[model samples]
Target: MPNSTSILSPIDVERIRKEFPILHQQVNGRDLVYFDNAATSQKPAYVIQALTDYYQGYNANIHRGIHTLAERATKAYEATRLTAQQFINAASEQEIIFTRGVTESINLVASSYGRAFLREGDEIILSGLEHHSNIVPWQMVAAEKKAILKIIPVTDEGELDLDGYKKLLTSKTKIIAVNHASNSLGTINPVKEIIQLAHQLGAVVLIDGAQAGAHLPIDVQKMDCDFYCLSSHKMYGPTGTGILYGKKELLEKMPPYQGGGEMIKEVTFEKTTYNDLPYKFEAGTPNIADVIAFKFAMDFITELGKENIAAHEHDLLLYATQQILKLPAVKLVGTATQKVSVLSFRVEGIHHFDIGQMLDARGIAVRTGHHCTQPLMDRYGIEGTVRASFSVYNTKAEIDQLIEGLERIINFMK
Candidate 1:
């Protein structure tokens, strides 16, 4: 249960929980206690209804039609872009480009901007805490362009070593890409400071906001990052949809990521001319239904207010942490002072996979693996950890159930 006294005001979690239809189901014999929110959040009724509404009512390709359905679809699709622009406080609608998810968003920037601006021997600074999606794209870009990759070390506490990061910056540093929050560890990074420091050396900063999008407040203008990527699935929206926000000037200067129907202003065997800003990057038919549904998800968040959502999750995190700490032989990983709602831990003599399976039997879903951060796992000298992430809909009762499950697992295993 939450403490009677707290700094942050509590949200009506019970009321919010009712909005998520999936939570009402039984996974095993028991009611589902979903803790795998970091992997992907469960969709709310609003979002699911929005998806159904789009497919049943007005399903058509956007941006290239004169008919009623086409215009309706196009209008609905563009509405999401506007919400996303306002959601992140982007300077212009032209700066927001739709993509599959954060993976494609990062790949777009790496392929286009890296190839265009990065020269041989230029340096790209990454952190040890980066997800594989964040790491691999830059590595590919670096290898192809003969650019060098520099890394900021993560401390034992799962926080990035800012002192070490400062050392890596020099005239050769062309780009600095890192996450706003660590997906595996949930550490809230000092991105504003990072962007400021990187700018002093003329290095562009790209923040992977996959984990931060749902849990934290985002303002691209305030953060002053060159690029920011967010995944809709992580933000209580549909899967296979996301947005990449870049400064208009940078986006205008960089080449298009994909070449296809809508991306061309005019094309010929002799010469091809690209479309303007966002349309230049978004080619072919996008995931229109999911993208349309994503707007409702954002609307849900906006209606509840991000501050209230964060407060609710933080209370859950604190409650889970306190209860989990009471159990024996459990070692918490990523004890950062600031974090979102993720709690990762490893038992002394138990495999994380077994722990996950045992918990699943009791209807408590959790993530168990290196969490696509194999490099970060290697840093901590552990194979993997059991990760239980919270959301606005989670409650103390569900967390108590988790603690009870963990206790049972421990006593039975031992």
Candidate 2:
């Protein structure tokens, strides 16, 4: 069963904000109103404490030493793997392979799985809404293997064209990769339906859950996606650490992504054998401190409740969307009925960069660029958008600050 409560209590946004130390600071001589959560979230006190505790308590290399510090460190690190397995509801901890974030996770699959399976004339399906991490890796594989790349179209409203997706499937299609929720547009693609359709055509699916990991309830088993990826920093954890979850059978068959250290069972000049499941993919020392601290990040979301977080963020999205649309010549980029708390838009005759700068001066931080989805920006015939993404700690008061900031920018610049 999913982690939710029948009795949905309203989120105490003020109390939640208190957990984040960064929220208490002043940026540009004004109270910080952080809406750039889609890029990375501000860490809470406990999460930071987790890092300090690990280094101060038991900082040692894992899985090799018989010493006490090594055992303690190893236990904490592997415990996070199990926590992540339950966080996303992966079938087993063996399926969770820690990596350098979503970019490296996708590259791991494209390099290992693509090398093992993808062949000449095979087709790989992707979406127009995918982040460049999802796009460029497969593009490299397609180019190398002489395979073809197909895209599921996006509508003017920024929703995926399900009908367009159906039209693209063929026997030659070997793989399909898409984001669980688009980072740029916050369009929640019908991932389960997409996975089912791809399965019927005998193609495996990979869902980039970098954005969804923080905002949405994810069950890899329920979604039945062949692979999933996450960025720890996007979920309020430390940077340089993330997860790549694949089915045990699939991971068993795929070759190791990197060599040396814990990834190998035994090594010699004559021959080398890989370790089992996750260890096979996790190379080198791994992001030990961040991985240990990530447990607190997982605990933070779980303790607050995923449904509660979604509810709070949804309210922020609605309020921000309503207030921003009331401004002159302002157009919302994505109008997807089903979305998380990401609000991306642009005012007519104002460059997105200028809007970003003006808002920053008001102590309102937001993401302004293609949001690593340049192709998605190109689809709308715009250079980029001003993206204000919300999180559980955000409040309606912050949204008002954003609205006021935008209103002043439009009025002064025009």
Candidate 3:
């Protein structure tokens, strides 16, 4: 549970800073300034230690094991599911299905629920700002089911065109999928409104929360979304571990996502009865250690409180934006009023790749390019932009270094 604290309470930045060991290191003879939080966050010492403890102590397969070590491992692994349930305010642990990441989570839904529920000529709506993970899965499923794929357009400010979305919704719409926050633009979509609208059109909604999971406070029930996906790596946990939350009734109707040991109740040449809610989606041996360690990552966020973390990151965003905007050649991308800590931009007369490379030489890491939102890049008529995303561990001092580096790059290029 999150501590009872004021949202504006000052964060113990130094204490929190100590939790992340990687932040103390140096790169290229300069202090490492990690601004690639949109890609993946640096894991805290507790999370790292948790991973070490799991492998060093109870390195065993989870579930269906009778030994003491197995029981301990299973207990820890299942505990993460409970933590995840609480983290998202989910109805029950049964509603949470573990996967490799958001990509796999979306793919699972596209292959299973999509195959079962969608029919020929049924339409699946995606937004123009969707990551390839959200787009590709729907495309694959739509093609397989002979369904139509529709898109919700974006405005110049990078906000979703709700009017366009409303026009696209119809009786033929079976699924409406969109990201909670744009990875490239940091545009926060009105998912609750979108979900309600989709429900009115008799369509299910899936929110790709890959970017929003760590930064936003999410409640599946409040949002009324049929499905929500999260990537643990983006949230300061290990890679290759994520979650898919689906409504119980909807999950019960969908078939198992994969065929393997734990997903089965009874197996025979004649037929195989599938296991219950979560196990139905989790096939084969799962990433036990990482899943077990993810609880610490969740705990880290809970301890800080999501609102406090968001407020601090918001300060960083505003400061960075104000500083970057003063630069003569810098052009800010994604001017949406509602956004997370992502600040994407491009400098005049300088390629994004060149900016990124020069920044890397100064030990500042920022992502460059389309950020897996090719459609969005196409919409903006730019090849790519340099993206500097923030996390709870980041500081304004680092942003100062970033600004300095960008200024140097711009002047040198000019």
Task: State every prediction's TM-score relative to the real structure.
Answer: 0.97, 0.98, 0.98
Residue lDDT tens for model 3, 199-224: 99889999999999889999988998
For candidate 3, the TM-score is 0.98
Better of 1 and 2 by lDDT: 1
lDDT of each: 0.94, 0.93, 0.93
Off by over 4 Å in 1: 1-9
Lowest summed lDDT across 10 adjacent residues in model 3 is found at 1-10
Best by lDDT: 1
Q: For residue 223, give model 3's deviation from the true position in Å.
A: 0.8
Off by over 4 Å in 2: 1-7
The weakest ten consecutive residues by lDDT in model 1 span 1-10
Q: Over the stretch 1-414, how does candidate 2's per-residue lDDT look in tens digits? A: 123334357787777777899899899999999999999999989999999999999999999989999999999999999999999999899999999899999999999999889989999999999999999999999999999999999999999999999999999999999999999989998999999999999999999999999989999999999999999999989999999999999999999988888999999999999998889998899899999989899888887788888988998899988899899999999999999889999889999999999999999999998998989989999899999999988988889999999888888986
